[model samples]
Target: MVTRTARHGSDDESGDADYGHLQLTALDGWRGFVAEMHTAPNLLPTAVWTGLAEDKRDYYDDDRIDHHSRLLVVQTPTIRQVIASGRRLVQLNRNAHSGRCGLMVSGPAGTGKTTALTQLGKTVEVIHRRRHPHAADDIPLVYITIAPAATPKMIAMEFARFFDLPISRRANITDIADAVCGVSRDARVTLVAVDELHNLNTRTRTRAGADASDTLKYFSERTPATCTYAGTSLERTGLLSGTRGEQIAGRFEHGPHRSVQPGPTMDRAHRRLGRQSATTPAPAWITARARPLPAQAHPRK
Candidate 1:
């Protein structure tokens, strides 16, 4: 049986009627109208699309993947560091009974924090699949996007979907938290990535006092999974300076940055005041007025 709830809004020419007033046939007609609005004219189906629209959109779509690949090209060092840290966490989890760690990857936008975390999760999943090909599928990682309007219950529900856990609408915050912890414990998930953490403060107004530091600490304390907070530098500092920030900081081990050399197409010698080594490539970009030079011209004297 279908249940309908009337939302507060302006009524049409017809007097306001409870949404439940629509008969099955009328509901079908309404569904057809919506389908016509969204579908391409030439491809419209004879039957109407009657499915309920989903609120959560998949974050890792094809476009997202392409964007991430380009991000990796520009932020190779950060990507490498994130991958290495994730691998270290996986190894630690395998070695310890109470495997818990935390990482805060902070940088400006377009710096590849989300992309790095996504890559890390994929790497862990690949390793897990190779190790236990025959066993039942286990969730090796969980990724959640925190928004400003996010509540503890909403976060729990998102985690529930990720783990394919059955969650009733009546489920409380504690219940959802328990489900998440339970899944991590049973599935041996290596890490949990929380993206857009800055959104957390915006989403949960009531839980504004809920210190991210404390929540993260409690999560790590109760689960064997490492928690990675990927967001802006400001968000990272806020979390790190929060009540349980020290605990969070202690769990993570930071990696060093690596310098990248420009490609062969670019020339560095003319750009530099002093003579340069033949082996070193030029910077990626050059001014439009600069003249192109032969590779032999860059040879060491």
Candidate 2:
């Protein structure tokens, strides 16, 4: 009964390239959360939103209607496993007597690494909403990306910006870090997701990069929330190299990384054998033609 919407934009001016919004809906009790990617306004939907008025929907043309508005959730094994691990980390942070814990997800580009973490944040937000339904103030998860050319001070500033804390432009890095940790604790943030952590290890700012790594470690040690980092292959980015990188690595449990696939097998016998394997069932959907029918009827149909 809880939902949070996250908006993202695309560069295409045509608008069709835009993804509507990411949302999370919590199911009954504390069972689980549903993650949805809605279609951008004016964009075609693969399905219609549930409970839409009969008169307002088009029963026939899927491209003419917004199927993405519906309560559709795609729970791939990757997403489910990531969500489970994140949930466990949150619980660990919640019940632990002291210190903190973390998980890291690494993979190549276009591997849905960010998507997994985004869904996990949505679920965490839903849990926070359930607990503080009336307050509407607590943020269960905090998400931030290390900006290009970021330093330890810049990283601290990003947290300050997220919490909307008004701090002096001249505040030292130490002060900013302290402020971020205090706010995170008081807000009861269960998880902190740092995306594009690869940016921290960029070569231009060698000294600053090392400091940035240490800054993240400090955040993990001082904050109550579990920190999850997502980036291109951690090893390739040198994210876990050097003394500070090693320190950061020691604090985190490396979760699954989407492994690069081996080259295609060219064996004709293997291909022939694969073709003989059993077929999978069609996806469950009620439709007219190949397009799924809207849950609600159209007045004309």
Best of the candidates, TM-score: 2
lDDT by residue (203-297, candidate 1, tens digit) is: 23334525443455566667777777776653443454544445555666543222233455334532231234344664322121246789988
Candidate with maximal lDDT: 2
What TM-score, over all chains together, does every model reach?
A: 0.57, 0.65
Give me the overall lDDT of model 2: 0.66
lDDT of 1: 0.55
Q: Check candidate 1 and list the clashing pairs.
A: 147-199, 148-199, 148-202, 148-203, 149-202, 149-203, 150-203
Write down the TM-score for model 2: 0.65
How many Å off is the CA of 244 in candidate 1?
1.6
